[model samples]
Target: MSARLRPTSLPWSVYEHLAMVVGLVSLAVICLAWLPLALALRPVLRGDIGQRLGRLAIMRGFQLYLQVLRGLCACRFDIEAIDALRDQGPMVIAANHPSLLDAVLITSRLPNAVCVMKAEVMENPLFGAGARMAGYVRNDPPLHMVLECRSALRHGAQVLIFPESTRTPGYPANPVNPLSRTAAIIAARAGVPVQTLIVEFSSPYLGKGWPLHRAPRLPLHCRVRLGRRFDPPRDPRAFTTELEAHLRAELAGPKTS
Candidate 1:
């Protein structure tokens, strides 16, 4: 019953220390690279090349950030079903928003991705300018945002969206509204399949109410599983239910338990 008795073995404290060192170090690196470009050049760039390069740079920067954070904390990640992302086309990349870093990870791994982020993230001093340069979407007028997502997909861009619309603080597992199906709608309209990702970290930093400075490091074990693609339902309600179900099932793996 004990972890030592089980096939897998590792000390709990080791995981914690690894998490702390990695998180802090990576956070520092992110501030150094992303903050500068986001603050300085992001405002000056425009058009496709600028946007594309910005997104790619920011995503890559964040990837390094997460990697160093996990390494320092002594946390590790194991990804499965990577082939699901191999086939390329305009895709609806939907995933559970567990941490602020989730989008960064997803974007870095996926090509031609335009994130569906909150309007505020576009205004935040830390993320706003870079997000705009990357041509990420804002959570604006419900119908209009959906339409814009449709347009982005039509233009041959893979659109990434957190169905929950915002970070899940209170009930991280459960969705907030469950009414909005913006991602699904866009997928259905474009006749593209939805690619679902379940991102789980052994212990996360930004999820819930933990303050940034006071946050404790837990082993930053991350499992990114890409689920089987499914067609968006014709009916809006059914589409939403199916999307949510896919995400939950992907994240609720017994192996994770």
Candidate 2:
């Protein structure tokens, strides 16, 4: 029989701490460096040009951050599966959010993908400027969020959303949170397929309620695998049920390295 997977250990060695610092500083540098450019171009480059530039910048920045992690932080990521969706045309890219890095992992691969971010994060100075310029949808005032998602889909951009709406609660015990119907509703209204992606982490380092100041185990491993894609739903409520069940099943099945 296969052995049950255990949580990764948190080590507070000097190497581990230094790795964490490197990861955090590299990310901050990348985001801050792009902030000025993003802010400056926000008004001048409106519409598709702005979106393309913003999303591309975010993607490349994230890619560079991941490279830093891999090089100096002993992090391993298997996220190539996401690249397949880059040219899949307009679609709702739904995923099970396990950690804070889920969006960064997926978006780093798809330059044309726009995220569905929290209303507050969409206003934060650190990330808001670039996100706004990327034409990312803000998850507030439900009606407006759906309308914006549909518009982005119509523009042939993949809409990246976490159906759980936030990081999954109760980690190992609850593989996923009950999915919000937003993803289903968006896909239904946009007439786009819901492409599911399953994100797994070696440990719950940056999961819900995890502290930013806390250091994690070295050699953190993260993997993203493509999941089932459901056709545009005629009944969003039913689709949410099915999507939630499917995600739970996939996450519960097995652990892969």
Candidate 3:
């Protein structure tokens, strides 16, 4: 898949909204079905087994979602280094946020991943119940979020954090937002390396305000690549600067075949 990472109007735009509605309804049903099970099974799937099961459910759901998007929406994916995550450890998997799907893609691949999600999402009807029960971290009160993530990492679990803290403004050389340094702080204090993961989509189907009805390129595609794993620098400010530069380079690099 050729990498353009920009938006373009296409014929498929016509079906985009319909597909989205169908997908959303299906997802609601799926989540509704599992949320209760997650609540009820909390006692039985206790300890490591419960954690594993929850993550597995998420992964399988994403797998199915990807299939649906591919088949119904004609979107394609070019993902690399997914298998590399399996061998990685209790490390901070930092990423450049592009779209909401970014987290799903990574968390799906890293079955043991502990994601740090926004407080609103933690209370959302579609995701809240399941996520809370599944043991993901809530991004609130910076200290609690940091401690939770750090503990998860120290316990030999992979933690995914969008260092940008929110979706990007959506363009190359875009101004990096002044955001929370929670991710950087967590990695530094925990003595874990920050693995920078770069995600570039062929179509910016969902930008800041772009609706699900917006039609992007046919067979929307994306490229997921792994960048360097950096040992936490002593200075958090310097680390954030370097991380931004590194992510910019990764996002601006030549497209892969």
Q: Taking the tens digit of each residue's C-alpha lDDT, what string does model 3 give over 197-246?
A: 88877655575556766645555676677888899757888888888888
Please identify model 1 stretches exceeding 4 Å from their true place: 1-25, 28-32, 35-45, 80-87, 169-179, 255-257
Candidates 1 and 3 compared by lDDT, better number: 3
In model 2, pairs of residues that clash are: none
lDDT measured at residue 72 in model 1 versus the true structure, 0 to 100: 60
| All candidates: TM-score | 0.80, 0.94, 0.88
Better of 2 and 3 by TM-score: 2
TM-score of 1: 0.80
Full ranking by lDDT: 2, 3, 1
lDDT by residue (1-257, candidate 2, tens digit) is 11332233233366677887888888889989999999899999999999999999999999999999998887899999998988789999999988899999999999999899999999988998899999998999999999999999999899999999889876756789998899999999999999999998877878998888877776688999999999999999999999999999999976534
Say which candidate scores most in TM-score: 2
Q: How much lDDT does candidate 2 score?
A: 0.89
lDDT of 3 at 128: 80
- Candidate 1, RMSD to the unseen true structure: 4.4
**Candidate 2 C-alpha RMSD relative to the actual structure:** 4.0
What's the number of clashes in each of the models?
6, 0, 1
For candidate 3, give the lDDT: 0.75
